[model samples]
Target: EDCPHREKNGWMGDAHLAAEMAFYNYDVAHGYTKWLADIADEQRPSGEVPGIVPTAGWGYFFGNGPAWDCSLFLIPWYTYLYTGDVSIIEKQYPSIRRYIDFLATKANEHHIVAWGLGDWCPAKTETPAEITSTAYYFKGAEILSKMATLLGDSGSATRYAQLAEDIKASFNRQFYRGNGIYGNGSQTALACALYQGLAGEYLTETVDALVNLVKSNNYHLDCGILGAKYLINALLDNGHADVAYRIVSKRTYPSWGYWVEQGATTLWERWDGENSRNHPFFGDVGAWFYKALGGLRIDEDRPGFKHVNLNPIFPEDLDWVDVHHESRYGNIKSSWKREGKHIHWEVNIPNNTTATVFLPLGRQGEVREGGKAIRQSIARINIIRETDDMKVIYLTSGEYTFTFVNDQD
Candidate 1:
């Protein structure tokens, strides 16, 4: 219902809609991707798509149109992961390339692509000519490069990789703030660049800076909705999962988990850091907590790809943490027990590829997929040489049986 003017309002602008679909509540996210496909089809000669589609009576807030900024870079990646449709990728490549071309033209003399801060952090008064803008260009280049590799554009992949490298060099030279923080932009964006590998050698230092910044600034990064989602992910990916978890669990008036604790089904625009009653946006809330904090990661590299990494860290004292995810591959029903000694996971692999299960030490396991028995064994942990000589199983992605124990019989 977010993009109601398009005649098909069921799936439009429902970012958290994916979590619902994952939980088997409904397939609203799927429908939303369909709408994205429709919008992708209508790109101009420049291949740019509007960020928002206007609906009658929806007004400017609802009809913000497409963004010619970094947000545009996320479309192709999001599309592929949610739907696992490669044909769409091929169809959208030209438009994506046009976007790349636009960036190439915007590159500074140092070949760094600089963009004005758009739709990310507020109070980020720095103009387009600032470091955040260039960082945006760098981040976009990295994404486009990956999309190209996935689409079989080896030539373009190489080109974009080179461009990304150049941007990294430029970012460090121009944005690196010698005190372990990247000074080119806001702390959140800098953390993202590092976590996503866009920051190259600057990764560790940037993360250190972000950690300190959050702590010193009282965990308030002056971020908006768009920026908060990214900041959290960056923290998780860079091995600061604990720090990231704190933001979600911080009970201060505006922390992420604070809203959920307040009985909110969705997230607000700003946190209590900025204001206690500042709830401007409705669509932004539930989405981030479900995807990021929930640690719901779907590996889109393999379509109908049922491989998911379930690493959930529930806040202290929470009885149990659960997340339901939907993939073009199959359904993921998973939960975590913080107090449990061993990790437990159960999923239905999409019908087709065989699943290779990795068991934790001290936990012996047996699995049967499609009614066939699977054998298990042990291997050295953190060892240099590994052998698959331990165990093997064949599963056709549908329904299967999984049983494991802390002691081998």
Candidate 2:
């Protein structure tokens, strides 16, 4: 009864869970797709989806509003990218388009979409603009624009792209505080803008900012399990792949795994670095663990057999890893073991696609999978799986992985 904010459905938790499921287990495709549908059902006519559905009890968090609504727009694109189902995009297009239109109405002369009320709106005041909010806004609009183009809605595409560009320009002009740094929405906004390609020519600067954010632990404390997961993704996407890998693998107290290792069935709200169970932001920490650690990416661009880079930076003491993911294309299970001389790698990619597997860097060798001798060239190989068959590639020494369902193959 105390959870007046979210009751109708576990909105915040569900979004994070959807990302977890979509990335970790391939079997949950139907359930994940249905979850997105359920969310669309609750969307207000005004294009504002509450952070917490009334049915779920929790309405929204204190720091921000509308900022989370942008995730609603991302859900459909995430699904379509995996299933390659133009139908999903078509089904969600009208609603998404309407939402974008609504956001445009909210935009100021600067084309910057304002976050709701005082939530994260610059020093937590009633400022008209905020970097974090606009970052998500532009990023979402850009994705929607791409989806619109894919759906042949040139008008919507142009409109959304223009809006996205406007927001990006505004973000660079306003949020960037010099020294290749950014503020507002913490590093989360900075990373999202860059990873989503809204950073333009400033990718390196944005990437540097992301590194600085992680180093400074800005979002780390402000984030709960869910926020940390998203933060990790932003780092990985913006050329900080190595740092992202460290955040995932680090087992020190207060880490993602630390909570799981403490005999907790689900993820804890706060890390040991923060408060314990009494923390106000507590939800499901287990959800974020599998998602970020499993390296399950929700991409809107690749429809079949999406690109996966198996680069995990584990501590010297911690080595082996195994993960299984269920996608719209099908199921993929990957395993990696660090042998003294080489990494024993095995990947089972399902039917109807090809996987470009990257052999360990600097290592040289040929391995077999799907009943064929995988050719090793330039320390990487493209393993193409047609139908129910599989494709496997071997690696030498150093570090390496593959990009499955990529544009190249």
Candidate 3:
């Protein structure tokens, strides 16, 4: 259902675009697991999924494209990622393989999938459906490869990895127009490519293009639901979170802040606040608050809250963020405040769990925990890795407080 009133349907695109947000904030394993079975039951024998589940034989040939169809793969995958439940993946394996085969049937000779309702409801349509569709195909294949490895099917894993590589090559060849332009170089185009791992060697340029696009828009969002999911993370993941922070903080038209100015009680169906003013299509932005702003993250190698990753993006002007999630293991929390070149961070990891805490506090020697140097703070915390901008420390379940001061951090 998209809105509280009017035309609430089992739209597949809505499910996936918001899937990550849902999984991050709530415990939805059982519900999504059963839904996966029901949705797979609706899968056509031709390996195609209807755009809507529980359909009365419609949506087979209409509104069914890579973006909508990719939901079938992502829903279960997110379930596994958040819950560490392999049973759902096992249950949906056959259906998953069939869906991948269906995508193959749709791909062109160059391996690009050009069909789909792409970047649905764009603020200013720019990315070609083909670009997002093809990238999603690659993402689906890559996830499937990881699934195969988890299922002890090394052969399939290698096969799908190869397929994903082929799709990536094709996507880059067809869409990477050089100089960071992808299919007219809309914010959605650069963002989708950057977030989907399709940017390859041109990642830096792609981020620059996305940043420039947002700047050109006066820090307003030019993407709608589909591109909206990837846009923030793409910028944040590429070390340009300062730019991302500016975009989201804008209180102008076509931005979330404008919705606030409009006294929006909920997100609107469209950026301009037309149609249903309360809609879920663009609600995935909530996920960023928890993951990027709060810095609570997941480790693919240790799915669920079995292992946590804390990588906060401290906005330049924002004061602080406090976020916590009750994982299957226990409560996982991260809170941080910046004070004039100094930072105070507090983290709580649940019993029987561990975390890789990323502290972006300049050089390794400058960061301290409990009033001691990082290296001296352990028996519980260990400095596992360090880079120019961040010190990655591993710690066991417990409450920990860290402080660091560096103007350049």
Candidate 4:
């Protein structure tokens, strides 16, 4: 439902984001595949994808933007990523290309496509609509290029790659101002720039400004629909996981916990209970829990469960985290706990699958697997690399319990 008091339709933006979690949490391939077909059937003759599938035909006349139109590219791309199914791309390729072409028609002389919803609902923001739309435009091109390459369409792949680079150059030249400043210092603008790699040489300054913006807001998120999905990951990538956790754990106004505190059993359409009480668009934080905190990642190169990435980040505030994802291959589990000065991490990789585990030891040298020391002579376990704080190990399918002392103390 858009709102309990308003229309209840399957909006593209909500479904696109919600689909991310569904693909991870449950077996949604069958239903999601059908939905993708339905969305394709609903496409207009002009190649405009509606904002809401099975609509009364309102969004097509208006309201559709890069953020909304991107569902076409995103759903199939994400499906391929999770299931390793190329047929979805094969079926949707033509429509996806047509839609991007439609978007190209909307671009101004500078290749800046700026006509869509920008950060739909934040209490306050300084990011502009042009920035959000153009950034997403760039993202769509980037994903389409990948999809083209995967489908063996070399010409389309090269074309989309060039298109993506052009969009990025245009976006940076128009929006970025050398330092952490982007179109009036809006959190959404800076976060989008950082998330999309549009900041270029200004990445460091942009990240610092983003952290300061979050800190200034008392560790609360100040983004809307467009920026919310990328903000947490951007923070995590830039060595700000602590800040991400703090924002997630925040229980005050305008936060996820705040909604839960207000008796929300499901995600709300807005930060405040001003509209629909049941919405999944803003509930992307659930994916962050499993991906960032639990550290269960599906390798893009090895899409599906063929190769799993276990890089759980143990926040100093949390004692332990347990996460299990049932991939197309099988069930993958990652659980870690701190007992005194030792960190015990246990992982379960499904049969016929391999995993790369990154265990945090914090400079402690003693590491063991199944009560046996992990050394260069180990047959099944390969110590890929050892940094100052973590050990990276490559392993085949099996249940393994690794123990190491956290030398931080």
Q: After TM-score superposition, what is the CA distance of residue 244 in candidate 1 from its true location, in Å?
A: 0.6
TM-score of every model? 0.70, 0.72, 0.95, 0.95
Writing each residue's lDDT as its tens digit, candidate 2 over 1-409 gives 1133333244433453245344344444465566557657766687755565434423533322445565466656656665666766777777777777677777777766566532221211122335546666787788888888998989989988888888888877776666555555355456545645566777687777668767776323234323454556666555455576566555555465566677665443346533233222233233333333343444334564455444332223434667766655566656665655444555555555434443323223334433344453343444443222233332222233432221111
lDDT of each: 0.51, 0.53, 0.85, 0.83
Off by over 4 Å in 3: 338-341, 362-365, 386-388
Q: Is candidate 1 or candidate 2 better by lDDT?
A: 2
Tens-digit lDDT string for candidate 4 (1-409): 2545567777788777677788878887777778788888988767778888777777886667888778788888888888888888889888888888888988998889878766787756646788988987898889989998988999999999999999998888898776687776777888888888788788899999989989999998888876788788788778887788898899998799999899889888778877777778887788889888888877999998789888877776678888898887788998889897787888899899999988777555778888888884347688899887778989998888888886655
Each model's backbone clash number: 16, 28, 0, 2
Candidate 3 structure, TM-score to reference: 0.95
Colliding pairs, model 4: 3-276, 4-276
What C-alpha RMSD separates each model from the true structure?
6.6, 7.5, 1.9, 1.8
Tens digits of per-residue lDDT for model 3, 1-409: 5665786677888888888888877887887887778789999898889887768877787877888888888988888888888988898988988999889999999999998888877777767889888988999999999889889999999999999999999998988888888887788888988999988899888788888878888888899788888898888788887777787788987788899998987878888888888787788888888888988877888998899989887766777888989889988989888887778889999998999888876653488888888788769988887777778889999998888864564
Preferred candidate (TM-score higher): 1 or 3? 3
Best by lDDT: 3
State the lDDT at 218 in candidate 2.
30
